[model samples]
Target: MKTKDALYNYCLRLADSNMIHGQRLAEWCSRGPFLEEDIALSNMSLDMIGQAEMLYEYASTQSEAEHSADDLAFRRSEREYFNCLLVEQENGDFAQTMMKVFLYSAFAKQLYESLLNSNNETLSGFAAKAIKEVKYHLRHSSEWLIRFGNGTDESKRRVQQAVTNLWRFTQDMFEMNDADAALVDNGISFTTEALSAKWQLNVNEIFTAANINIPETNNTITGGYNGIHTEHLGVMLCEMQYLQRAYPDAKW
Candidate 1:
């Protein structure tokens, strides 16, 4: 693949994942367990969306069609989105939500940190800005996970179940594809293997402290990089793109 095409897909993968994950987190608006948490989730959702917008903007510059960031985000079909399957999973419960947050933030933090060293200036700058946000995200979710683990029987049971259910999808986050390979060759990105190893170490420490064991699951679900997502993503896009699709170029 040409470097420009590779870069565009790389940006789309990151942007799409952030965009979808932000939308999922946005669902908690006004529904958090408490006022502070509600606001926190909203703020985090904004952070993710803002990052996605910036990435989408850069991606637009690389496209021959000269698509806008909104076009890239709101006009894409489900098969065109490259977000990881892990981010597209339903937010089952507060515990389930936090598990997803903790896991994704852990991986994101490492990914962004490594990107800080990317040969691409734009990506490195994005990484510098994003690392700060993901750090806070990791801290907030990690503390919450620990609380759930040690708080009560119900909390423990719920969080434990969430871990078991979500563990299978975690492997999907580390799946590298052709775009990733091209980016790595050009020093624009790093290997998922190293990222996964660091992610696992950090998660292990937190899980050990939280009294939550990593599930012993041999099954792994992937293919999101290749645009093969769970049914959840298509449903999500229908709702997310409803306004854009129903009224083309409509604006507030």
Candidate 2:
């Protein structure tokens, strides 16, 4: 029973992460710096929303309530969200957005790779499907990172600053809790500790290729795992849950 609960929590975390990030990406729908990028980010947003649906569907199976994937995603309270802090951070400039995408895609790619071998069949299946999508996400983000980092002086300067600003929040992505412990013990989930090292290597490679240096800041902002998030998440939740809250049970 404990194992099942742990798995359920793990699934919700994954679902929330994708759902929140997808919604944020969708904000770039018509605002992308260029047409090609506009379509690209929109496509990524759709992929994340699709992945969130799969994860939330799996999570709903573990609950007694008849909550659908949309309910779990659109109806949850702010404190109920378990996504990492990185996803909720404000999309600053184009460089900032690219930095967010690069860092997150790198982490997700490594995590999904490890999860593909999880002992739990559901988790393994989800990871297998997500890995393919995240690979393209990584490629897209990496290409943009390189372009901005090595582009004109103003572009390079902005991307470099973006990288520095976002680095502090990266540590939260590896935070583990009791659910993670249980999942690790049951061999149903990969260890964040193990993934951290690989994530560093992956990010460093991209930074090197882009001729951008990882920031030297020692400050790390944590807390999204335990339900403590930034002010930005509240605004995001307000926008995301507005219709659901305003029109309770008014589904199409």
Candidate 3:
């Protein structure tokens, strides 16, 4: 990447999104619908956190800043985070959470699939490995969405509501900032607009089988790229960052 800062920022965007989403999934550690599902969510949480760590490590190598991966992962203030609005959303219910994951995983699958050929070797390798986990996540979440859609009346009601409530944030996932434009121009990153189009197709295919209707509109909620997040991120960060903040140098 010619502009190191742009590449670094892009990596932070990817890592921050993964870390926050993983933390949200970890909230279901003991609260999944069943024991098997509980274990599944925990595993997914680990997978996302691991991905985040790898991305952070790569970013650290590229950055002149002294922030370690842990510092980058935990020390940044809320406004410094560049995650999409989708991942940081509050987990509403079983259906809502699954829908959220489905949307993100679908995007990740296509984004990484294209990134396998990135000019940046570190990013290309990361995409190759991360795509596998993303595929499983897409499959898992899509299956649950189908089940919820075809199940009892209440199940159908809840899942549809999840779709309606979360639809706006979906558009924000593709909203790119200057750093993203710079990386894309330099071939260090893929264009999220193209990725977003593919993601919508995948989402439509799954939603079709589930008999769920997608709301069509130009009204999209964004600003996460600009570091403006919903109230949910602040809450999650407070809880997740408490230990690190309380003892800045705490070590095991």
Candidate 4:
């Protein structure tokens, strides 16, 4: 891929990851396990949506036609989204949600750190702004993970199961392709391979602090970066795309 194509793909991947995860988190709106958690989840959802808007807006500029950020977010098919499989997984329970958030925030924190030095000025600026928000996100999720992991027997058991179930999907977050390679070579994007080590170290420390044991399972699932997704993504995209598809050109 050319430099521009690589940059466009990189931006879209970032946008899709945030958009999908934000949509998932928004499902918790008014449905959180508690009042305070409800507010926190909604705030995180808003933050992720804001990040998606910034990323997709940049992606739109790289496209031939004038595509709006909403268009890029809600009008795309599941096969076209470049988010990792982990973000699109269904929110099973409070424990499961926390697990997902913990994993994603850890990765995002590292990703934004590297992106701060991107050769692409817009990407670098966006990363500089987003890293601050991601820092809070990481702290919040890590605290929740620690609480649940060491809270009560039931809480610990449920969160442990959630971590086990979600672990397979974690591999896809660091899965790099030719686009990533191109961007990394040109300094337009950071290599996720380099970030993965730090991400794992951070996660491991959090797990230890939480009194949770890392699963010894070696079954790693992949394929979302190439547009292949689990069954859940279709349902997510259907609900998310309904308004835009039902009434084309509709705007709030």
Candidate 5:
């Protein structure tokens, strides 16, 4: 692939994850455990969507055809998206949601931090702005995980179950293809493989503090980058794309 196409795919990978994950978080609105927490989730959802919009806009510019951010985000079929499988999984429960956030935020923080040194000024600038938000995301989710781990025996069991269930999907976060290779070679991005060790270390630290045990599993799941998603993503896009699909040129 050309370098421009590679960069465009990279942006879509980031943006698609944010858009889908944000959609999941939006499900928490008016449904949080409490009012304050509800508002917090909504705000975080907005943050994720905002970041996705920025990325989609940048990606749009790299395309040969004229397409806006909305077009890229809403007009694509489920198979065209390149987000990690971890972000597309259902938010099972409050504990499950927190666990998912902690895992993804840990990976995202590392990914964005690496972008600080990117040869592309646009990516580096986005990283500079996004790192602050990602830190808060990590911290918030970490605190919730700790609370769940240290609370009632029931809470501990639920969270432990979440860890086991979600652990398999973690490997998907590091999956890469030619787009990643091209970006790495051009100094516009680093290899996802390089982030694995540090991601594990950081995760171990948080798990230790939370009194949670990391699952011992050799099994790995992949293919989200190649757009071979679990069944959930197609169901999600139906709702997310409904308006745009129904009214291709409709405007407020």
Candidate 6:
């Protein structure tokens, strides 16, 4: 029973991460720097939304409540969300947005790689399916990272500032809690410590080539796993849930 509860929480965390990320990316729909870049970000948003739906669908089957995907998504309160701080962060500038994307895609790619071998078939399958899209996400973000970092003086300055500002949130990506412990012990999930190391290596490789400065501070922000988030999340949720909250069960 404890394991079951842990699994449910784990699933919710994964679902929340993807859903919030997609929600944030959707904000870039028409706001991208260029028409082509705009469409690319939109496509990435759809991929994340689809991945969230798949995870939520599986999560819906796990508990007695039998919650639907939409319920787990639109109906959940801010305190119920388990997304990491990085994705829920406000989209600051185009450089900031791309920095967050690169950071998250690196983490997600490593995480999904670990999940591929999980004993839980639902999780493994979801990882397998989402990983391909994550690869594209990484490629796109990394490309931007290079261009922005190695471009003009202003572009380099902005991307560097974005990295420094967002660095604190990176630690949240490797956090582990009771649910994570249970999942690890049960062979349903692995320790994020290992994934974090690989992620750092990948980041270093790219940053070296792109001339992007890695932040020096080791300080980190946390608590999103515990349903505590930045003020930005509340505003984002209000926008995201307004329709569903105002018109419950009004699906076409």
Q: Pick the candidate with the highest TM-score.
A: 1
**Residue 50 lDDT, candidate 2, scale 0-100:** 94
lDDT of 2 by residue, 22-105 (tens): 988999999999999999999999999899999999999987678887789888888989999998998899889888988988
Give the candidates in order of lDDT, highest first. Answer: 1, 5, 6, 3, 4, 2
**Segments in model 6 whose C-alpha atoms lie over 4 Å from true places:** none
Measured by TM-score, how close is model 5 to the native structure? 0.98
lDDT of 6 at 127: 94
TM-score ranking, best first:
1, 5, 6, 4, 3, 2
Question: By TM-score, how accurate is candidate 2?
Answer: 0.97
lDDT of 4 by residue, 1-252 (tens): 887777788889999999889999999999998899999999999999999999999999888777888889988898989999999999999989989999999999999889888878898899899888878888998998889887999999999999988999998999999898898888888777779999999999999999888789889989888899999999999999999899998867
lDDT of 6 by residue, 1-252 (tens): 388888888888988999999999999998999999999999999999999999888888886796899999999999999999999988889999999999999999999999999999999999999999999999999999999888999999999999998999999989889998888998999998899999999999889878988888868899888898988888999999999999998878
Q: What local lDDT does model 5 show for residue 234?
A: 98
Question: What does the lDDT read for residue 12 in candidate 4?
Answer: 90
Number of backbone collisions per candidate: 0, 0, 0, 0, 0, 0
Instruction: Summarize candidate 1's per-residue lDDT along 36-155 as a digit string, tens digits.
Output: 999999998999999999999999998978799999999999999999998899999999999999999999999999999999999999999999999999999999999999999999
How high a TM-score does candidate 3 get? 0.97
Best by lDDT: 1
Error of 3 at 246 (Å): 0.4
Q: List the residue pairs that clash in candidate 3.
A: none
The TM-scores, one per candidate, come to 0.99, 0.97, 0.97, 0.97, 0.98, 0.98
Global CA lDDT of candidate 3, please? Answer: 0.90
